[model samples]
Target chain A: MITPGAALSKSAPLLACIGLLCAWQVASLALQTESFPTALEAIRAVPSILGDKESLVNIGASIRRMAIGLSLAVLFAIPLGLLMGRIKGVASFFNPLLMIIYPVPKAALMPIIMLWMGVGDMSKTLVIFLGVSLPIIYHSFQGGKAVEEKMLWSGAAMGLSAPQRMLRIVLPAALPEILTGCRTGLVLALITMVTSEMIARQSGAGNILFNALDMAQYDTVFAMIIIIGAMGILFDAAFEKLRGWLVRWSKPQHDMPLSFS
Target chain B: MKVVSLRSDVQAEPAALPGVAPAMAMIHIDHVSQRFQTSGRQSHLALSDINLTIEDGAFVSILGPSGCGKSTLLYIVGGFVQPSDGAAKVKGKVITGPGPDRGPVFQEFALFPWKNVLGNVMYGLRQQGVKKTDAEAKSRKLLEMVGLKGYENFYPKELSGGMKQRVAIARTLAYNPAVLLMDEPFGALDAHTRTRLQNDLLTIWERDRKTVLFVTHSVEEAVFLSDKVVVMTRSPGSIKVVVDIDLPRPRKRAELLLDPRYQKYVVDIEKLIDDTGEDEIHA
Candidate 1:
């Protein structure tokens, strides 16, 4: 049923991606600098870099940390946000504290965290957790607070108890917004994990990049960068798939090219 | 256009209707007044001394100008709002809060966006602890009654305005409430859809004869679908007139349009609202 134009539109993103890689390859070859590796060189380097056990261990460690940190942040922040959003007493008690701490740069807190917890996995994971939790809490709070008044009245009229209303009506209504928050938290968790790894010289993807740069393994560095970028894209795509499956009732917008019957 | 005085005879004994059984008050609103605090000190009175009685199995429409507290009065009867003075009672019991006994269909068609059509219709029954098999059977029947037989799997967002309201009506009826309170259920629909729904509603009303208190601004709609139309004054609303619509049952829109009696009823209610000197907005 899809038209030619629809097929073309779907391939547009892939075309743009190929175009960007071609431009990067051209620029890198023209410059011929040791610091910059051509796209071909970086692509050639990926197989060797991945095959190496040290680099593989680093990549695995980074992903594992990000997963744990992100999972914990989502688990803790969602409940806290829902409670604060639904109950006036909880909101009043926590609002001032959240406002004050939410904006302080997580990177700036690393030194203090290191001083308290020492330069280890504990401090790095804690930094990532702190960075990720703030946005999740804020967005989930907005989502929980935004349940329509009319919907609440309708639920009440249907003889639903307050708890039943919250579970069946309010929670589902807020889910899309909460998922958006989780996606944002995922990106933040990845960034904070790398930054913490680099600062602490820990065993992770960032540590591999630092070591390769020190040894002048330019191709290896570029290959690691591409791997990290691919991971980010993969995580985002996974979240989008989850959103599509869970919030199936919220239809996606139809902006595709016109198709004849 | 002609004006008739049906108000004088009907106001004397509110329950005295021909062909209906000995009267039993299903909903009794006695001097119900609602005042809302606008700001720190200012208060806006919505309804004032609105006393009315809706007999069991009667279809009554409350007609008024927009923002004249017609919805507030309906909400009070539905127990969604508490009156500042007096009380609204259903079957001799004071209504403190919303219950399944008085089902309400809102103007926005407040359907759950997450649930599909069948799920929304089954929601009340599920909450009331009905078995899944029975609830599904009853819900499917109600959906069929509302002309939404094959649309059971569709979400509220996928439905048209008329369809969404149809789902809301089906959902309300599935719960089997004693008194149905609809606040301008067809207000957002187009004229064609509105008339079709009006006819459909009348058909449904004729079958079950559940007591209905419908609120709307359309004088023609009130005359066509209601047994009695209670017109209210502007702002701090009170009962202005009650026009008893004695039009024969199973009325047809095309035939009723040419009927002189139907025309007179519409004209009378229109004149009563016009006499209030309020500019016509959305009712």
Candidate 2:
């Protein structure tokens, strides 16, 4: 069903990316320096990076950390958001705390977290959790609060109990907003993952990038950058697909244009 | 039509006809007044000294202009909003909160977006502890009654404005409530759809005989549907007049339009609504 125009639109971003790579190649040729790794050199380094068991281990470790931290964040955020959203008094009490803490760089807490939890994986995971949890929680709170009062009244008039109303009406109404929050949280989780690895841990994609820098392996660093970019794009696409599936009942069933990461 | 004759000798004194038994009032609004306190330190009185009694199986319409507290009165009757003074009662019991006995349909067609047509209709029955099979069967029947039998799986977004409103009505009726409170339910629909729905509603009301308290700004709608239209005035809203429509039973839309009586009722209602500077009544 892909028309010529649709095909062209799909390939447009890829074409632009190739053009950027060509420019990089041209610049690398002009420089003709060993320190400046050419596009070909970075492409050749990809297999070696993939072949290295240590690199695979690092990727695995990073994925595991993300999974654990994000899962914890999801668990904590949903209920807290629901609580804060449904109860006005609770929302008012916590609003000031959330506003104050949300903007503060979660990474700044790294040193204190490290001091308390030691230089363990727990500290790194905690940092990532703290960084990712707030956005999800805040978004859920906003989403939950955004449910129309009329909808709630309709449910109540139908003789829905408190729990049934929350589950059947409130939750579905808030799904779109909560999913948007999760999308934002996913990006933040990745950023936090890299940052935590760079500052605290000796494993993950961040560690590989850091080590490449230290060894002056510019081609390997460029290769890792490409891998990271691909990973971010892949995660975003996956989450978007998940969101579409979860909210298919709410949205129109039409193919949407894909966005480059 | 098969008319079953009642045995008048069964009782010492026949109270009334079988259909017009001395039916108890299902919903009673007793001197209910509501006020809103704004942030500007001024209190706005929405409804002032409103008292009305809706008998069981009666179709009453509260006709007024926008912001005339017709909707406020409907909400108070439905127990969604508390009255500042006095109260509303259902079956001699004061309404403190929303319950399945009184179903309300909002003007905005508040169907849950996530739920399809069938799901929305089944919502109330499910909450009432109806078994899944029974609920589905009843919901399907209700949907068919609302002319949405084939659109059970269609989401709210996919439905036309009129279809969505139908789904809302079906959802409310699924609970088998004693009374239905509608707040400008067709106001958002187009003229054609609104008229079609009005006809559909009259048909359903005739079949079900459920009490309905409909609030609307359209005098035509009030005249066409309601047995009695309680016209209210502007700000500090109170019932200005209650015009009884004695049009013949089993009414049809075309017939009502052709009838001069309907036009006269509309004209009188318009005059009453237009007369705004009358002395206010304080309870």
Candidate 3:
């Protein structure tokens, strides 16, 4: 049943990864810069980074914090966003504040947050939480707002109470949009995790990248970049798979696929 | 044209079927009016002092032109929207909000997009605390009744316009509502599909004469499907006339299309609607 287009599209992500590496290989070879290593050297260095116990544990800790931050953000934002969408007063109440906060780079707040709560995992996690919350909330609001009134009426006619209608109808109806929000929030969580770590100079994948740069270990630096990129790709692809399954009934909302492989 | 009239003025109030005791009014929309707040402080009058009594087990169509508040009146009866001035009562009790007593089938179909045909049909039954196994069995039967037996797992987005409406009808019927409020349920379908659904609806209706309050702009649809057609005028919409459809049951489209009585009713209702169009222009 697989169409030719789908088959080609299936391999597209793998093809993209190889193409990027090949391009990087050519560019580094052409430049012949001591600081910039070839793609093969970086790929070779990847085993060393993964084999080191400390680096592995550091990466693990970073991921753990990310999971906590993202989970907390999702818990806080979805209900608030749904309320904002359904009630005009709630939307107006929060709109101005969200607007003021929206444009401020959340990673930039690491320093300020550190001043208040120090540079523990707490401050870094808070930054990730802030980075991830906005998109999910915005999307959930749009999703909840877009729910058809007639659908709620149908639920009501079936003897569903108001809260029952909101829970059973609005939540499921808004799920596709909410998941789209979570997808964006996922990538943002990674970027925020790395950026906040780089800013705070804490122990994580970002710290490894910074430390490699300090000692001029260009291979380690590029290898860490590849590891981070791989994590981003892997997380996004996995999330996309889960999202598709959860909202199988929904029409394809976006054109871009996150590369299944 | 009614501010308040004897219930019979709207239609035969008692609706005494021959050789049967007369049934009580299924719905009493007493002087209901609706005003929508537009931009600025301006308010637009939608329904104007609407008063009508729909008899029990009667198939009544609220036929009108676009923007005539025909659908709004149906919504009022379903208790989705409260009237700005008056109230709508069903079975001698005021309709404060939507309940299982009155189920609505909207033109949009309003099926839960997330639920498959089976889940959509079973929603009401599940909500009513029906056991899982019993609800599943009943939903399958209803799906088969709606000609969607094999499409139990198919989502609403996967179905065509007519099929979706069929599923919607089955979903509302799942809870066994005493009154069915259909707001132009067939308006979105093609001529062929609409015709087929009309016949199918009537066949279903014949089984257990649920009091139906249907709304449609098509005179043909209204006349073909209802026991009475309540013609309405727009822009502060109100009833213009009530035409009793005395056509016999088990109406065959092929034969009814050629029947003089059926053709005459369609033509007369079309004229009535046209007159309202003229009145709208004059106003």
**lDDT for each of the candidates?**
0.86, 0.84, 0.89
In model 1, what are the clashing residue pairs, if there are any?
none
List clash counts for every candidate, in order.
Answer: 0, 0, 0
TM-scores of the candidates in the order shown: 0.91, 0.92, 0.95
List residue ranges in candidate 2 displaced over 4 A: A1-3, A32-35, A252-261, B1-19, B277-283
Identify the candidate with maximal DockQ.
Answer: 3
Sum up the clashes in candidate 3.
0
Instruction: List clashing residue pairs in candidate 3.
Output: none
Which tens-of-lDDT digit does each residue in B195-240 have in candidate 3? 8899999999988899999998887888888888998998889889
Q: What level of docking quality does candidate 3 show?
A: high
lDDT (tens digit, per residue) of candidate 1 on A1-261: 989999987887788778988999999989989899999899899999889998888889888888888988998998888777788999999999989988898978999899999888888889999999999998888988988866887889889888888778877888888887887898899899888988888699999888889999999899988888888888877777777789889756352232111
Q: What is the lDDT of residue A38 in candidate 2?
A: 89
**Given the true complex, what DockQ would model 1 score?**
0.64
- Name the top TM-score candidate: 3
Error of 3 at B249 (Å): 1.6
- Model 3, global lDDT: 0.89
- Candidate 2, residue A44: Cα displacement in angstroms equals 1.8
Candidate 1 backbone clash number: 0
